[model samples]
Structures are given as structure tokens and as C-alpha cells.
Target: TVNELRRQRKLMEKLSMEDHLTGLPNRRAFFDCAERQVEFSKRKSEAMALLYLDLNDFKGVNDTLGHDVGDELLKSVGKRLSTVCRKSDLIARMGGDEFVYVLPSTGKKGSREAETRIHQAFEDPFSVKGRSLKLTASVGIAVFPDDGKTIRELLIVADEKMYENKEKLSRESKRVTIT
Candidate 1:
């Protein structure tokens, strides 16, 4: 009985850390891992990058295509992100079409490269339930020691930057429509 209980506990822990739909690490897992990474980076004096990404027009997709299709799209997005990231990188779903990436031992240049790769990955449409859906994400990046000393602080900065990027895109789209 004790062994079975232990096994159940282990399973529960694993499930708690993973996003059920996308199979990516959940927010709690991200924070737990990020805290350790931040400490390691500080000890080694290494640069790290935190990226906050939010899907653009995700709500529209859910409303138009139904939740099942939206869920599939999230899973596809997760897989796409995994393909673009290195073995060392940490990718997590921060719930509801928002994801976070932790790049250890990476600086501004590396972050920019990663961001470019992510954009390129989105160039192809994701197929969900026999439908082709185009998706884009607004990414905000913050480098360690430059942006913040702690993971929470870095996340805050990254989230703010992501919102700014989303606003810029919205404005640019409006301008293009007007012209």
C-alpha cells in the first residue's frame, strides 16, 4: 500500500508540472526551474534570457474554430517551439495561449536569434482537424543581470515587453489596412 501511494504521488507531481493539452511544462514547473537557473547563472556570471510569448488572435481562433481545434493548435505550437529550441532550453506553457522560454547562458544576440527562429517557424500554417490555421506570437525578451536579478522580475519585464510588441503589431496592421 505504501509503495502504491508513493507511485501515485510521483504521478501526481509529474502531472501537476505538465500542461495536459500541450504536454509542455506548466507555469509552476517553469517558476521552479527558472529559480534554480537564475541562481546558477548568477553563480557562474553567465547571461540568461527570458522570453514571454503570447499567441496573436488566439481568442478569435477559439471562437471561430471551436475549442478542440484551438487545443490542437496549442499542441502544434508547443511542438514547433520544441523543434526550434535547444536541448538546454526550457519551454513551458504559462496557460491560455501564453508560453515562456528560458535560455540559460544566452545573451541578447542569442535571444534575438532564437526569436527570429520562432518567427520563421510560424511562417508555415498549422494543420488542425483538416484545417490550415496561421498563427503568430508576440515575443518579449529580457536578458539576465541587465533586465533583472530574479526570475520573477525578469518575467515581469518580459511580459511588459510582450504587451508592447503586441500593441506595435496591432498598430502596424491598422496602418497597413488604412493605406
Candidate 2:
């Protein structure tokens, strides 16, 4: 009976830290790990990068294609990100159509390279429910010690940058359309 209780507890803990849809670490898990990483970076005098990624036009996908297809798209996105990231990197789903990545011992240059790879990963269409769907994400990167000292502070900076990036992309698309 005790062993069974322990197993249940372990499963609960795992479920608590995981996103049900994508099976990636959830927001709670990301924050917990990120806090530790930030402290480690501070103690070791190492640089770290926080990337906030928000899918562009994700709501449209759900609206047009249905939730099942949208869910498949999110899972595919997670798999792509996992492939792109290193073992040392921490990638998590931060709720609907949003993900966050923590790159330990990485600076601005490394973050930019990671961003490029992420964009490249999305270049190909995602096949879900026999339909090929195109998607892109707005990525915002913040380097530790340069951007913020705490995880929450870094997230705030990264979120703001993500919005800025999204706006920039919107403007660029509008310009292209106008031309």
C-alpha cells in the first residue's frame, strides 16, 4: 500500500510539471527550472538566454481548422523544437501557442543563432489531419545579466520583446501586401 501511494505521488508530480497536450514541461516547470538556472548563472558568472516564442495566427488555425488540427500542430511544433534544441537546453510549453526556452551558458550571439534555427524549423509546412498548414512564431530573446537578474524580470523583458517582434512582422507583411 505504501509503495502504491509513492507511485501515485510520483505520477502526480510528473503530471503537474507537464503540459497535457504537447507533453512538454509546462509553465510551472519552466519557472522552477529557470529560477535555478538563473542562480547558477549568477554564481558561475555565466551568461544565459531566455527565449519567448508566440505562434503567429494560431487562433486563426483553431478557428478555421478545428481544435484537433490545432492540437496536432502544437505537438508537431514541440517535436520540432525538441529536435532543434541541445540536451542542455530547457524547452517548455507556456500555455496555448506559446513556448519558452532557456539556454544555459548562452549569450546574445547564441540566442540569435537559436532563433534562426527555430525560424528555419518552421519553414516547412506542418501536416495535420491531411492538411498542410503553415505557421510562424515571433521569438523574443533576452540574455541574462544583460537583460535581467531574475527569471520573472527576464520573462517580462522577453514578453515585451515578443510583442514588439509580432508588431514588426505584422508591419512588414502589411508593407509587402501594399506594394
lDDT of each: 0.91, 0.91
Error of 1 at 49 (Å): 0.2
Error of 1 at 28 (Å): 0.4
Q: Give the per-residue lDDT digits (tens) of candidate 1, residues 61-174.
A: 888878998899899999999998999999999999999999999999999999999889888888888888877789999999899999999999999999999999887652
Off by more than 4 A, model 1: 174-179
Q: Which ten-residue region of model 1 has the weakest summed lDDT?
A: 170-179
TM-score of 1: 0.94
lDDT of 1 at 112: 96
Clashes per model (N, Cα, C within 3 A): 0, 0
In model 1, the clashing pairs are: none
